[model samples]
Target: MKKNKAHSALLNRYQKLINISCDLASELDLNILLSKIVRAACEVSDAEEASILMYDPNKKTLYFQAATNLDSQLKRGLVVPLDGSIAGWIVNHQKPIIVDNPQKDKRHFDYIGKITSIECKSLLGIPLMSKGNVIGVLEVINKRGGGFNKEDQDVLLALGAQATVAIENSRLFLQSDLIGEFVHQIRTPLSALNAAAHLLKSNRVHEDQKKKMIDILEAEIEALAEMSSSFLDLARLESGRKQYNVKEFDIRDLLIVCHEIIINEAHKLNLLFILDLPDTLPLIRGDRKQLKQAFINLLNNAVKYNKIGGEIILKAIAEKDRIIITISDTGLGIPEDERSKIFEKFYRVKSHRDHVPGTGLGLSVVKQIIHGHGGEIDFTSEVDVGTTFTITLPNEI
Candidate 1:
C-alpha cells in the first residue's frame, strides 16, 4: 500500500509540472511572463513571496526585474550583489539551495531585507539555467509551512527550467521581428536606387533624362540613409537602450514650433496650416525632443496628404489631469478597410502608395513615443473627408 501511494504522488506532481510548463511557454510578454514565473514559484514552493533577479552579464550584477510582494519602485533597476549573496552562490555553482535557517548562513545578503522591507527567515533559490549557462536566479522566500522540503525544491527547479526556455524564446522572437521589419522597409528604396543607377548607365539617355535619373539616384540615396537612421532610433527606443530625456514644458510652444516648421511645406501645397492652443495650457511632462519629432511627423502627414486649399488645424485642450491635442487635416482620408493596418510597421495605404511617398514608419514611431510616456493615441477618419489624430498626454509622467 505504501509503494502504490508513493507512485500516485509522483504522478500527480509530474502532472502539475506539465501544466505549469505549458503556461510558461504560452506567455510571450517579457514583463508579464517574468511576473507570472515569480508568482508561480511562490505557489509551487508554498512560499510567502517570490522574486526574479536577471543577471546582467556586462555588469555582473543581478537586478530585481519581477517580484510578487515588492512595489514597482523597489523592483525597477534594483540591483543585488552577485558576490556573497545566496542568489549569487546559486549562479556561481549553478544549483538549487534551501536555507532553512538563513540567519545562520553567512551567504545571506542582509541589505536585501532592508531594501525590499520583507523579512527573510528562509530562502529557496534555483538557478535559471539555459544550455549549461546560469542566466539568472529564482528565489522563493519564507515558506508558509514548517520548512521547505525536497518537493518544493524539485517543483521550483522545474519552474525555473521552463521559464529559462521561455525567456530565451521571447528575446529571440523580438530580434527576429526587428530584422524582418528592417529588411522589408529597406527593400523599396534600394530597388529605386538600383533602377535609377541602371538608367543613368544607359548611353541612349538624353541630357534631361540623365539629369532626372541622377536626381532620382540622389533622392533615393538620401531616403535610404534617413530610413536606416529612423530604424535604428526606433529599435533603440523599443529595446530600452535609449533613455528618455524627460522634462516639463509648455505644450503650446511645441505646437507653435511644429506649425512653423511645416507651414512652408503646407503653403507649397496650397494648404492653410493653423495652430490653436490656449495660452494658459497645462505644462506637460515628456521627452521634449522625442515629442517634437512625433509632432512634426503628425503635422507633416496632415499637410502631405491634404488636398489643395484644404486646412490643417493643430489644436490643444486641457482636461483635469490630461492635455488632449488634435491634429486634424482636411486631406485625403484613410479608407475604412486600411485603417486597421496603417499603424503596422512598413504598412502604407494601398491606394495612397502611388500618390504619396512614405516609408510607413512615421506613425509607428509616433505611437511608440506616446506609449512610452504613459499616454494614449486614437484617431478617426473618413474617406475623402479628413482624418483627426487625438493624443492624450497626462500632466504627470
Candidate 2:
C-alpha cells in the first residue's frame, strides 16, 4: 500500500509538469518560450538552475540560448564543442543522463563554469529530439535539495517532447508567412503591366504623347518580367525545391564584378564607390551567381537610397571560420524597430516607402539566397547614421 501510494504521488507530479510544458510550448515568442522552459525545468526537477542549449547545425556547435540563474545575454551564443562535454554526450546519444557529482565525471566540461563563474554540482540533461533527430539539449544543474531521480528524468523527457513540437510549429508558421507575402508582392508589378497594355491600345493620345506612353509601357513590362523571374527563384530556394550550387570563389573578384555592373548607375548619382578587400582572400564556397545577385541587390539599394554626392563602401574580411562581407552606405538608415522585419518578403522600412520605390522583395530574396547557402544576413542601422548590412558565410562554403 505504501509503495503504491508513493508511485501515484510521483505520477501526479509528472502529470502537472507535462501540463506546464504544453503551456510553455504554445508560446510563439522565442525568448519567452526559452525562459518558460528554463523556469519549468527548474520547478519540476527541483533544481538550483536550468539552462537551454540550442544547436546550430551550420556551426555544428551548441550555444546557450537561455538560463534561469545566469546572465542571459552573457550566456547567449556561448558555443560548446560537440565532443567531450556532458551536453554534447546527450546530444550525440539522444538520451537522458543524471550525474550526481559532475566534478568526478570525465565527460563534464569545466569551461562553462569558467565562462559563467558558477559551480555545478550535479546535472540532469536530456536531448530535445524532433522527428527522431536531436535538435538541442535541455539541462538542470545542481538539485536544490536531493539529487535528481527517475521521476525527474521522466518529467524532463516529457517537457522536451512538448518543446520540440512547439519549436517545429513555430518554424513552419514563419515559413508559411514568408511564402504568403512573396505571393502578395508579385501582384503590384502584374497590375502595372496590365495597365500599361491597356493604355497602349487606346487611340485618344497624340503621336508624341503616345510615343512617351510606349516607353513607359516597355519599362513597366520589363520590370514585371524581371520581378517574376526573381520571385520564382526565391520561392524555389525558400521551399527547398532547389539546392544551392556551392563552390569556391574569390570574394574580392565577386565585389569587383558587382561594381563593374553598377558603375554607370553609381556615376549617375555622383556617389563615390570604394572597395576594401584583401589581396589574397580564402576561397568561399557558395553559389557565385546567387551571391552576386544578393550583392547587386544590396548595392542597388545603397545607391537608390543615397543622397547626391554620398558614398558607398564594400568591405570584406575573414573572421574565425566565417567570412564577413559588409555593404555600407551614407544613405538614409533604417529605423531601429523596422530592422527586424526587413528580411520578411515584401517588407520595407517605413522610412523608405515614400522616398524610394521597390518591389520590397529585394532584401527578402537576398536573405533567402544567403540562408540557402547556410549563411546569415543581418544589419545594424541608426535612424540618420546610415545602415550597414553584414553577411557571414562559412569559410568552407
Candidate 3:
C-alpha cells in the first residue's frame, strides 16, 4: 500500500511538471518567464524559495536573474563569483549539488544571503543545460520537511531542462523582433541623407538651396544618431540584461533636479512651468539614475509638445504605500484612437509627426524603466486640450 501511494505521488508530480513546461514554452516576456520558472521550480521541489542565475558567456560571469521570496530588483544582475559559489560550482561541473547546511559549506557565497537577508539553510542546485552547454543554474532553497533528497534533485533537474530551452527561445525572439524593427526604421533616415547629399552636389542647386540641403543633411544625421542610441536602450531593457543599480533616494530632490534641467527649455517656448510638489516626500528605493532618466523623458516631452503661452505642471503626492507623479502639458494632446499606442516602440503621433523632430522611442524607454522598478505608468489626454502622464512607484522595494 505504501509503495503504491508513493508511486501515485511521483506520477502526480511529473504531471504537474508537464503542465508547467507547456506554460513556460508559451511565455515570451523574459521577466514573466523567469518568474514562472522559479515559481514552478519551488512547487516541483516543495522548497521554500527558488532562484535562477543566468550565465553570460561573453562576460564569463553568472548573475542572479530571478527569485521567489526576494525582491528581484535588489539582486537582479548581481554577480556571483565562480570560485566561491554553489551556483557557480553547478555551472562549472554541469552537475547538481545538494547541501544540507549551506552555512557549514566553505564554497557557499554568503554575500548574497547577507544582502538579501534570506537565510539559506539548505539548497539543491542544478545546472541548466542546453545544446550540451551550461547556460545557468536553478536552485531551490530550504526544502520542506527535511534536507533535499535525490528525488528533489531529479525533479528540479527535469524542470531545469525545460527551462533552459524556454529561456533561449525567449532571448532569440527578442533579438529577432528588435532587429527587424530597427532595420525598417533606419531606412527612412538613410534615404533622406542620400537624397539630400545627391541634391547638394547638383549644378541646379542655387547657394540658398545648397544651404537648405546642408541643413536637411545635418537634421537627418542627428535623427539617425538619436534613433540608434534609443534603439539600443530599448533593446537592453527588453532583453532583461540591463543591470539596475538600486538604491534609496529622495523623490522630491530627483524631481527638482529634473525640473531644473528642463525649465530653461520650457521657458524658451514661452511656457509657464510649475513644480507642484510637497515639501517632503517619501524616499523611494530604486535605481536613481534610471528613475531620473524616466522623469527627464516625461519632462522633455511636456516642453516639446506644449504650445506657446501654455503651462507645464509637474506634480507629486505620496500615498500610504506608493508615490504618485504626474507630468502635464497644455499642448497638442493625442487623438482618442492613437492614445492606446503611444507607449509602443517607434510610434509617433500621426498629426504631429511631420512637424515634430523626434525618434518616437522616448516613452517606450520610460515605460520599460518604470516597469523595471516595480512601478506603473499611465496617461490621459484630449486632442487640442492637454495631456498628462502619471507614474506610480512603490514606497519600498
Give each model's whole-structure lDDT. 0.81, 0.79, 0.89
Cα lDDT tens digits, model 2, 1-397, are 9999989988877877768866876787555677888888888788889988877566577766678876543345446667988999998888899999998898988876774677898899999998787878999999887888888898888888887787666667656776687567667766876876676677667778887877877776776677777777766555333434455688778988998887789889999989888886787766788889999999999898887898889889987788889999888888777777888766777878877767677887888777656588888777666678999887753
Ranked by TM-score, top first: 3, 1, 2
Worst 10 residues of 1 by lDDT: 70-79
Query: Lowest summed-lDDT stretch of 10 residues in model 2?
Result: 237-246
**Most accurate candidate by TM-score:** 3
Error of 2 at 149 (Å): 1.9
Evaluate model 1: give its TM-score: 0.70
**Model 3: per-residue Cα lDDT over 94-211, one tens digit each:** 8999999998999999976886788999999999998889888999999888899999888898999999889999999999999999999999889888877877777779998888
- TM-scores, all candidates, are 0.70, 0.58, 0.88
Error of 2 at 282 (Å): 25
Which stretches in model 1 have alpha-carbon errors above 4 Å?
A: 1-18, 29-35, 38-161, 237-250
